[model samples]
Target: MGIAGESVAVVGAGIGGLSLAYQLKKQGKPVTVFEAAAEAGGKIKTLHLDGFELDLGPVSCAETATLKQLLADLHLEQEVIAAKSAVSKRYIFSGGTIHAIEPSPLKLLMHPMLSWSGRLGLLRDVFIKPEAEQTHSDETVAQFVRRHFGEEAHQKLFNPVLNGIYAGDSEALSISSTLAMVKTLAGTYGSVIKGLRAEKGKLNMSRKIIGIKGGFIRVVEALQEELGADLHLATAVKKITPSENGVKLSLHTNEGEQERFFDKVYLALPSYACADLLADIDAQMASALKQIRYPKVWQIYCEAETSDQVFDGFGFLVPAMERKSLLGAICITNLFPDKAPAGKTLFALFCGGDRPYAFEPSVEQAVKEFHSILKPSLLKVLHVQEWSEAIPQFYVGHKKLLQSLKAWEARYPAIFFAGNYVSGVSLGDCVEYGLKINSEKGSVEVR
Candidate 1:
């Protein structure tokens, strides 16, 4: 069946699913979105408390072309606001204090965080040569960094930075898949340093970090408005069975279990959720998806009144070697002063990534522990949110799993998959993936 008149069913109402529905609707296809939650915007939830806007998830996003286009398509260009210049001032905690990350190479040479050997190792990156041949083989982020910049650099610089991004271990994450941009730079210019130098101007121009004026939920709200009655809430897909014509979905709703047939079915949930939905239809494929692991994360939003400025910079990251209870803290007020009331500092404390199971403490207990580490004068916890399985880990063999999933998708054209786990985890990646899935002629082949 042709895509224009074909019916499409999208499971999950997250950014990925909603974006896919929007794209399909733009193509004049009959699209319907099913969301298990009462509301849309899965993890992009924002809270308003005491006249302050607190984003429970994803404080900011790196502005990208696709994201810009999405905002334009949603008529949200006027709502965009660039982050303050101070947002670039990130810090790292070491030796019981926070230090600003030096921007200049000369300043880095005398940086307090790095030892003399580590400084020397960083300078060696320019002299390092990239691999001659490109292959499908993958290496851990730690391994890749050590090979090019030396072990000290990996431990001091790469490890903590990557931990903040993935909430994962550098020793387990695939460098080629997780840090594809860095790998591409290394491969293209024969050295990361050389590639960076060549693209310095372009990188600077593209580094604008932005957020919505009200909150990120505005984007979701706009999409929902555009979709109107096509979006369904409080609905879950229990089973998915492929059919000769297309696909059959068994949905569990408030009324009862219902059956629906569509030309194509798109799953925009996490890997495990998708695995469960497709288990009966494709056991092996579901089993492969079950292998993907997602780590637990606890986010604590707090309001503190300090007589003295606690620290400068956007936030500070704690390396695993520090043995601290907290992963890191984002100075939300510092990054965007408008987020909090005057004279009050707001912070979002994060914990429980790749940490020991024993570290899973109650919200109050965790806040008390952070108080000891942070040492703020009057810190009060405003809100706490826990995600049992938060960020997905792009483990060592992730590439092979992706290849297998792609092959399965090719075999069954009626089913499509889109999620953070499938592509990069950034919001931009999800939106871009949704927009790119359909054919150039605005239609997807229906089996």
Candidate 2:
């Protein structure tokens, strides 16, 4: 294998872009990272407001193998602060109440979240063989779950859980894109339950959620220190031009506009951002990039400090069937005690997903709904934040967009797209994709 470039330029300072820049630098490659924002860490922001430490973005990492290796490589293992065991636990709203989700699927047989018929239907997964055509087909998650686990499970169990991750409706999201592992099990072992039983070791069911010591900002700070001057903060990449020498970046900084050359350029920005950059380069590529969508969400952080107002465990998710304006709530204090004061408990309440019928959630609406879910005597609303362009949606036919991207990259070769739009929408997924980059080849496939 041979390196594609002597110098690499990474656009956007999000987790994905920074990870790529870090990997390229580690390989002894000259790397430059450009971020339009004054600070790095795109979605991994920690808000310190009114004596409360709230994580409006991702609160924990999945502790994947690559993340463990990353911490070791960075020699920042001390930042590996373990969360309370209860942080792994989650609850599902069912029958007008919240029920704790069992750690194992077998336990679902007795879980209150499912009706008698629905509970019994889960057993049938061991025997029912999915349609052969669906093994590799693009299908809606709602159809996939109903096909295997029955309608009740699809509504009560699958909807909220998947919503927590994708912030979109399961009926609209592509099953292969969202629940790929479980879907593959049905195609491979003839039954999802059987596949799970046979592949327990590979699944790593024992892995615990890893919360960073001081939200995710600590990791970004470490990366910033590692990159030093190679990282350009408050610098906007205006235009890109490809030539035989390399790609020239028209960078706009406080110092003024200037052109710089790089052997290659990797885009790790949002889909819309990417589309804007490549609109003139290739109309087909720009069209494909625009096809990807980012849904909006409102994350409201509040706390209840009174003894009678305390809420524990991970948090509860309201199934869409509940028809509530609230989506879910996270017990921030339970997960990271130091993030909240000793007497105070913080919770990140969320609403405003892709449900068209629902009204845009106001702070008042969220507060009332939060009261319905978790009643607290002394409810204090700390802050209300909205990400108009939140998590990327992987709707059905998403794979087609990915294929088109590959085709475009094949034609261009000098530029590649990365980040949450192409990554798996997880702290670990983005980091892993960047870490796996073949700096030797100076290219990494998003798929």
Per-residue lDDT over 1-447 for candidate 1, one digit per residue giving the tens place of the 0 to 100 score: 765688899998888889888988887889999999999998788888997788866888888888899999999999888887778888877777777885566676788888888888777667756554244258888888887777776766777787688777788888887887778788877677788778887664346788787889999999999999999899999998898898999889999999999988888899999999878878888998988888888889999765565656678787766666577788888778888888788988887776423454355665675676567899988888887888889888887887777777778878887778885788888788777765543323221
Question: Candidate 1 versus the native: TM-score?
Answer: 0.93
Q: Which ten residues in a row have the lowest lDDT in candidate 1?
A: 438-447
What C-alpha lDDT does candidate 1 achieve relative to the native structure?
0.80
| Top-lDDT candidate index | 2
TM-score result, candidate 2: 0.94
Per-residue CA lDDT of model 2 for 3-32, tens digit only, reads 743788999998898887888888888889
- Against the reference, the lDDT scores of all candidates come to 0.80, 0.80
Top candidate by TM-score: 2
Q: What is the lDDT of residue 281 in candidate 2?
A: 76
